[model samples]
Target: MLKAPDHQVAGHQARDGSLGPLVDGSGHFYKPLQNLDRGSKELAFYTSFNSMNGIPPRIRRFFPSFHGSETFQASDGSGLLPHLVLEDLVFGRKNPSIMDVKIGSRTWYPGVSDDYIQKCFTKDMKTTSMSLGFRLSGLQVYGSEESGYWKPSKKAVQSFTVEDVRLALRKFVSSDVGWASDKDTLPDCSLATRIYGGPSGVLAQLIELKEWFEDQTIFHFNSCSVLVLYEKESALRGKTHGAAVKLVDFAHVLDGNGIIDHNFLGGLCSLIKFISGIVAEANKALHGLESSADGLELH
Candidate 1:
């Protein structure tokens, strides 16, 4: 099953599957203001959905060993705590290229993809955003960053490769399909037959999951406070694509009070506005804001 990592909230309360808050997400005061301490972690399931490879909850049953955790401390002694963490979760596991046995479309077999991203702590670093990710199914293909990240930088500790575990995970998750080596019979299923909802549905689920993805990595660190981010890939009719769902990150407060006012959507809109202004001022490309029917914040 997909086991979630342990975590600290707002750099204070600590939470795990067993230990939980006595109240809802919003409460108040050490008086049980009632919370899952700053240490409480988010669910890091490969696929939080009901299916994987024709099997129900494929991501969970397949990658059983996938694990991770986080801890936080207020570095400035400002009553807010910073967080620290370590984990081995799959982020970019698809290949940049693929060939489908079916048609003219290029396909990826959860293609070779795995790597680490780092965030550095600086005096001016006020925002800490994060997100879970949504990936295309039937064909696992991930693209690359065309350019470097804009501002500050944090060096990742090591390199990662998706091929290291993709085969194993596929074996583990796809019960009906079996492993590529098995050469098993074609099960009474179609790739779409395993579809819990539809392509759009699966895409939406992936989009939402990105939040916890960062919670285990990006959000887990020593800082002013905790900031959770999430970006969901959208359902497209053509080639595969990935979208950024996560946007705003809350600094330190030991209780996650900063984001009390903004939900994930609100935070994202704010971020889009900020980026739009910057690009406009710098005369940077607005990507496809003008031509595309989808209205981006840069308008």
Candidate 2:
């Protein structure tokens, strides 16, 4: 049996008075669901990723570790729902600033082939939005709420915008000399150096991850949420600190045969191109700042 913290409610209550998914005191995130097929797919994804020979360690570092699942019956004997448990990514972090942004879709463009675009739209409209630009759909800062359950923080939500993404992309593009110069390589780099902490190590890691995903060829991340986490104090101090980017929500993952899926590739390429543009714009702004700072020093 799952036990919630004494001070915190286990799951969210719906308008119908039924319980939703809950997190236990042990830091296990339980996602309650009625769809068994979706649950099974997610379980398989976690299982495959968690296996020793499955996903690469560098790429796997960004994923939340999955535990297992159990069927929980309502106390009132109303019905049962499968509770999928996984390690809480935001747990134990001090005032962790978290943003759950749906990836893809926002950066899409109309210039892409109609057939490809239509295929992507048919597959998933949300994922196709990445070609448009980054859009802030939901934001949450853990620990701000007194109840311990995840709640949206207004201040934190306002802090990040499509502009921030642009800036981060600039930092990534400017600092990623290797990937930027290599015309043979795809336009992809790490956001860690720009927004989070340290140098450009994570960019290389991200490239490796992208390559790994490309190599798979059989599966594609249909729709996923990019979870960005950072310490509030670190962000407020304007200092480099620990931060993480995790990909979650695999309900829309698609599988295919050996043939390459152009629609999938198109979506991925669009997202990469969008990030590159954002980063380029950000780099220009950073150069301006540096020039101003240099002028002040010269005086």
Candidate 3:
């Protein structure tokens, strides 16, 4: 969803297929020197401050500064926040910059020599398909010793349903990214996280706005590059009784698998708006319908 420059995220379409930085699930969009020597002190040193532009300061304080900042555009009518910029995006007063810090223990892309996590993508490339369902629930990182499957931990992955998906995704992301939400108040923290670096309490809150276009939707993260989500408006007449899952195509979005599409960006902006409408309607539907128990435990 990143738009053209001065405000948009800086990205390069790598020949191999990634979007640039560490390679996407597909080997194409490669992050520069993402693979540094293993156990390298320098890599640890830099991550302490590198923002990657979105890492919260509390977390970022644990890493190093980024080499430079980059910009990406916000949605329409974003006004003052129209452009989201990585810190030091314009830090060129011939400043010493992150690069000159002297990587005494190593170079860029630390932990290079260690055997790569070696993701066994389906294709010759290293990408696979995953379902990104409603509510962003239960989303967890799973790896296979043999690249055979995305075996979700049994205790973690449960029956796949709209509510199930939403709850899991909400919990998984909130915990990893450090956000929280109400039990039934699925706020879109994925977007909220973008507006990072504010007070911790505020930054960790979700917009809870699922107000994009109507209809529940499902996203197919086939590959890291091309993400596709689909939801039908309504069935014409002859369609099957069982509701059909729809598909939206976005080829080569990140690698050969992602699609940072028009709808994608729009969805992020409109989610908050949509959720507001849902909450309003739910309240009207019944008293005490809203639940606030769904959240990541702050251990």
Candidate 4:
């Protein structure tokens, strides 16, 4: 059976009269097709991306595996619609923490209408996107099944500062912390070493993606989001089954025409730098604890 995604942290959502993405019990995500131009363009990009042999195998894992398209009845009673079938990133997780980070200071593409550019520009300036090269669209952190998910209001997220962005990244990987009450204080960041510091962690994966973005000029991903996800349950158990980094939202993707994608690259690097700092701080904190423990033993 298909239903609305409970873990979706951002973007368009299903409402009274509108439809959003759907997930099946079989671990498949179904995204409703947009307008003719955008829907077809996105499908083409995925098809072409998967078919191309030159795309490095290591980088390909960063994208959700596409399973083509399927026609399904719309949730809003708008009849049938075509949906893109993809791997459900949070399908099997018991308690998943997901964050959607939209890369690039500019979201519009070349040859777009002036009005569209202006709209995007205004929003970018209003948020951290313009200055920091990226913005946290939205996120949900697992706070136990009884407590439910902890997410900030849309207005609060829009008003976030540079420090707020860094804190959000740290909070995303933290556990059992009061996100709202402890806004000014730092979380334990105990999961930092495991979730963002290790070989298969988010930091390493992002650096790998950055390396690919540095050279690839085949496509310019406009307004695309990098989803950082991990299951709190699995992470606490010291398992890596649910940790991943996946690129999503291809409606505005454009042909690169051999030019470098400086916008996306710059934003990705900014995110990486922030993560690297967090890992370093977490290591120092751990070292401090160890030293204190040794001092106590000597006494």
Candidate 5:
């Protein structure tokens, strides 16, 4: 029997000899009937991911494996509700750190009219911006005992700005010289390494993924969580070694024709430029550090 993870939003594991795979169906955001549409969309998205053969193995590894969805009648005789079944991320790990953070700003669009932009800065900024990209919302770190659940570390819940993301990209790129040596080498490395490759490589993969989504005409992901998993026993004491990133949440995903949204494409390009700029800046910082060391030796 699969124990439910503390961060689960939609469904829970079934009890012994349960009729179906899912039990205790809780609708999205604590609303049983209201969120059926979102639940359906999320289920469909995972279904597609599971069946699609075109997705690269490296990219596919980042996503949680999706099981089939189940329908359960409401206890009050309301109607049938859908529940998505997924693999528990922390099941059987030694020490696992799970961070659930949303990405993107729903209201922060590039090149939008000032009127629209002004509207975003209002009191409902978070509510309005929730659909932009994945944002950090909830976090959990599991311990080794029966009471495995624990509060998230500060670093797990820490929020990052666009600049911070760019810096992270820069750092990853600068550090992984071997991975960045050949463009083809990207797919050979882990998902995190490829997604966080040198600015150009990372941007290339983003474009590739976006174009693939466009071809599939899958509605773009808005406000998905960037899930990072790290193990304590890995290299660097789990600080920088063996970390993986996967994107989740498809409640706002839309269906579309085989056309890419210009605004979305532009936003991606802008991010690429930011990462590139930071890469240059990081290089400068390293050069300065080296020069300082040499000067110290001379003195």
Candidate 6:
């Protein structure tokens, strides 16, 4: 049966008076189509992307495996609607922590309606996107089955200052019990380093994606999000924490033809810097902890 996705971090949701994304137990996600122009553009992008040749497998891995589209009974009781059938990124994961970071300071592309551009401009100015080149669209961290997920409100996310954004990043990788609090607390850097600093970590993967964006000229992604996921339970238990990064939401993708995607590239570089800083900080903190333990043992 198709049901509301349990781990959706951000976007138009059922509570927002719109049909939200759904998931089937068989490892597929169903996103209800948006307005005509946006949905058609997204469909076209995926259809083209899936069929294109010569795209490197490493770069392609950064995108969700597109399985085409299908009609589904909307979870909101709306009639049957055509939905994009995508690989469910969180399938089989227990206590998953997910984050959606929308890249780009300007979400609207040239040639969009003036009113639409203004709308996007206003939103960009109000959120950290204008300054940070990216904004935390939303995130959900598993606290416990009893406590449920720790999700900041949309209003709270929009109101995040630079420090709050840093803390939010730290909180995502933290296995601490006090993670749900709004205040800043130093995280145990082991989990952060393990999940974001190692060879296959988010930092490494994002740098790889940045390299691809630096040279590619096939498409310009506007309002696209980088979705990050890791298993919180596994991280806490010292198990293999399945961490992943993928690009999603192509409603505003534009043909690059021969031009480079500077907008997306700039935002990606900014995100890379943030993740890199976290990794460095985590490493320093971990080294300090080890040294302190050694000193105590000597005493």
Q: Pick the candidate with the highest lDDT.
A: 4
Output the better candidate (2/3) by lDDT: 2
Where does model 1 exceed 4 Å of error? 1-92, 95-122, 125-238, 244-253, 256-270, 274-299
Could you estimate the TM-score for every candidate?
A: 0.24, 0.59, 0.22, 0.92, 0.51, 0.92
What TM-score number comes out for model 5?
0.51
- Candidate 3 stretches greater than 4 Å from native: 1-160, 168-260, 263-278, 285-299
For all candidates, what are the clash counts? Answer: 43, 19, 60, 0, 15, 0
Q: Can you rank all candidates by TM-score, best first? A: 4, 6, 2, 5, 1, 3
Which regions of candidate 5 are displaced past 4 Å? Answer: 6-34, 71-81, 107-124, 127-134, 140-217, 238-241, 261-299
The 0-to-1 C-alpha lDDT of every candidate, in the order given, reads 0.23, 0.49, 0.24, 0.83, 0.45, 0.82
Tens digits of per-residue lDDT for model 1, 176-295: 432232445322211111111223322233333323332322221112211211111211222333221211111212222233222333333333333233333222222344533222
Clashing residue pairs found in predicted model 6? none
Per-residue lDDT of candidate 5, residues 51-87 (tens digit): 9877777567657777676555533344676556665
In model 5, the Cα lDDT at residue 117 comes to 66
Each candidate: RMSD? 19.0, 10.9, 20.7, 4.7, 11.4, 4.7
lDDT of 3: 0.24
Q: List model 6 lDDT by residue over 152-228, tens digit each.
A: 89888988877778888887877674657644455554577778877787888888888888888999999999999
Better of 4 and 5 by lDDT: 4
Candidate 6, superposed: residue stretches over 4 Å from native: 15-17, 144-147, 182-184, 288-299
What range of 10 consecutive residues in model 3 has the weakest lDDT sum?
95-104
- Tens-place lDDT per residue, model 2, 53-161, is 7556767787888887877764324678676778767666665645554555522234446875677565344322443323343544332234232333434333544
TM-score of 3: 0.22
Superposed Cα deviation of residue 71, candidate 1 (Å): 14
